[model samples]
Target: MSHQTGIKANEKLIKVFGKSKNGKLRVIKVSIENEELNCTATAEVKKDWERDYDKLIVPLIEESVPCYILYRLDSKTSLGYAWLLLSWVPDTATIRQKMVYASTKATLKNEFGSSHITEELHATNKEETTFDGYIRHKQDFAAPAPLTSREEELVELRKKEINTEINTDTRHQTLGGVTCPMSDATVAAIKDILNGTYDYLQFRIDLEEERIHVSKAAVVPLNELPRQVPTESARYHLYLFKHTYDGNYQESFVFIYSMPGYNCSVRERMLYSSCKAPFLDDLNALGVNVMKKLEIDSGAELTEDFLHDELHPKKFVNSRPAFAKPKGPPNRGPKRLTRPQEQSF
Candidate 1:
């Protein structure tokens, strides 16, 4: 019976026992199937010897079977080839495996050949299992309905809360409730240092106060600020204050601390104060300045003032130029004057 079949790339076709009409084992028609392309071919064998059949025809047939090639073998003499057609066999795993085994035996007759093949098979299986497990895990994660709306909302809220707490705590730590000392001596010392009058000196307590006030009043916010730890052990807070072009104050503050018995250097202190503290101070100063600039104490006042300024102006000036008398040039081209002779006529 004929059967329709598909073939694979690595399938093998086997030759079953068959005979020709001559009954002399003459016409050997080998039937093989191509697994990949699902085609068929017939080859005529020249010899009926098993060794010769295994050597040439078997290998070719085995290789072709899995690759979608179907074949029927025929017998041949010195003059020409003849056929002893046989029924086609379906390509099966057992058949292919047998063909592979035969081919391996034919090719690798050494004792270690079988062992090497076995090791390869074992390795392949192990890798297959590993790959399968990975695929399964990936599929599990990709499954639908992992998170419900409520769960997603909760996650987002948690993240927001965490961020808020972090920011508040950071602020609290940096600007510790304790007021910084602002002494007169410290202020004078700071001024001297800034003026290049002194190379390096600690601010006296009295000067420090004056310095703080002057610095705070003239503070301008720097672009970048240093990070500070929000812990009780933190030693000092850094701040920056600068004067704006519009005569507004900008200030930033940062908390700073050094290890016990380790005083901060002048450069370090300057950097911390100029960068970190000033950044925070600037945010605060901006809010304050915005309020002060508009001359409003509250949002309500600001809105009222904004409307007043936008809707009406105290005085208005006309931009157009005033009319003036023409001067210098007289009318030219055609004269419009009446001639005395024409008038008389």
Candidate 2:
């Protein structure tokens, strides 16, 4: 589902912002009240912009509350105003409050012209809201200094190595084909599944770190496959289905890709898609002959009957026999010349 911009900028905020330059307003603290972004408080410029950092902006912040501080800088922008959007979302704030502030940030900036926002600051702590912290934040994102000849050579070599690695598929000993290396525990779990100790294995991807790890592994029955899938996120499932087909017992390895469609983000869908083919290739390289591959949008679709139909499809046959000509009556004599009396007219 798409994220909804629930918080709207209030009319009072617009009016206050129009007069901010003349009113000497150094900072405007915007907050969510009744689901609208209202001007909760403001700080006036005492002497200059730098002096108000400690004297004005410091005292307005509450520990548990998340707020947006529009700080005016002395630097001028092309729009005749240079403002910094300081997103002061504290760690102590509630999850809902944090989500609201994060989602509404772009909308807030767009409502009040984005061109005036020269810089943005995201601070979770009181220390980061200080002037020194702002300087450090700028330095962290600042452009790097020029490199020496030797340093340039080293950088070029590293780039070449990275490009080579990207162009060529390098199979690690532990995690074979996946770009996101699987955890040691996940490798061991996969071994257990291959060895018949476990009949089911599930995996989850760490999107931030770009790693794949085992989420669950157990000896689950065929009917329990649906329950094993999570409903909120995407997952990779390996199931060993043991059932009787044609009066013979057989074991088939089934690979299931379960994605909770609307629940997953766009990044999640892309990550899972890129990893899927390589993961299957790795499984095949490890001696797993996957008999059936299934993709599902929900756990409810991963049922025993569904798997059975995928594994063994019904065959059509012609039950009716071929048509044949019947034998003619045997002729006992030539013809009994019984010329019927010419119709006695």
Candidate 3:
């Protein structure tokens, strides 16, 4: 989906997009077709924040990192997308768990917003290196250790290794010949996921003793699709990190209109409109670069200044036409009496 505007940086949704049950973030499997992303920043994290960042914060950043390359689709700059540097303490409060400072809006609009975060994830681009390492200033800076020793420990301390074996079983045809009008890249990505039905996936990784856990469930709605999309929206929200087994990390698409009670509210029902196609266009516009970034980060260099001028054209993004409010009666003065007519007669 296109990067939504007015998205607060520290929102819980962004923080936990790929979180699984038990609260221990796991690299379930990324089907590409397969995928993932990266970047880093600097911050002085407190003890509490450092603890959470090690377990929680890092995963959140990894999942959404692809979004940065999306800015490459925008016509505004040479780089094409917004720059982001997430500092645990600076963006979100360790206590409240919500962002408490400087303008995320302005920050996201301008790439390189975080001085310490400016270190590109792929700068070193090591395989197995998923999250762009952040600097914990409260702790003494070690020129040698890019990632925390604890993180290194986690990487090394393999309690048990389980395979998240992935297989491509299903192939998809684009909504019965009604193709989505998206960029080739975006279209391919969608086709990649849809091509296979995630029949099932399961496994487990013992993370840091793997003790505590939390039950997670959600309804992640797909962006409103244009009327032209022929695919049927699924009725249920597929489990976030799994289908049933321990490590099943398959995710499913959530159709906006096809959802149960999606239009249940009378007022909200009035707001329904047919702009799904335009939204798809916008997503595809952003998809090409996002895909490029994803590819380059796999083990190559993606220059921060890679420039592209053509933008995915969007319509009615900001325009809000009046919907339900009644139109006022036309201004008409009461019959001016027969005086003028009678005088003329």
Worst ten-residue run, lDDT, model 1?
116-125
RMSD of each: 33.6, 13.6, 25.1
lDDT of 1 at 199: 27
TM value for model 1: 0.14
- Provide the overall lDDT of each model, using Cα atoms, as 2-decimal numbers: 0.30, 0.79, 0.26
Off by over 4 Å in 1: 1-177, 203-257, 261-345
> Per-residue lDDT tens digits of candidate 3, residues 89-135?
21111211111111232344242233212222221122223232544
Count the clashes in each prediction: 59, 0, 12
**Top lDDT: which candidate number?**
2
Model 2 earns a TM-score of 0.48
Tens digits of per-residue lDDT, candidate 1, 210-285, equal: 1232111112123222212121121232332233323655332222222222143332233333333443344244
Every model's TM-score? 0.14, 0.48, 0.17
Q: Which stretches of candidate 3 lie over 4 Å from their true place?
A: 7-86, 89-117, 120-158, 161-345
Show where candidate 2 strays beyond 4 Å. 143-345
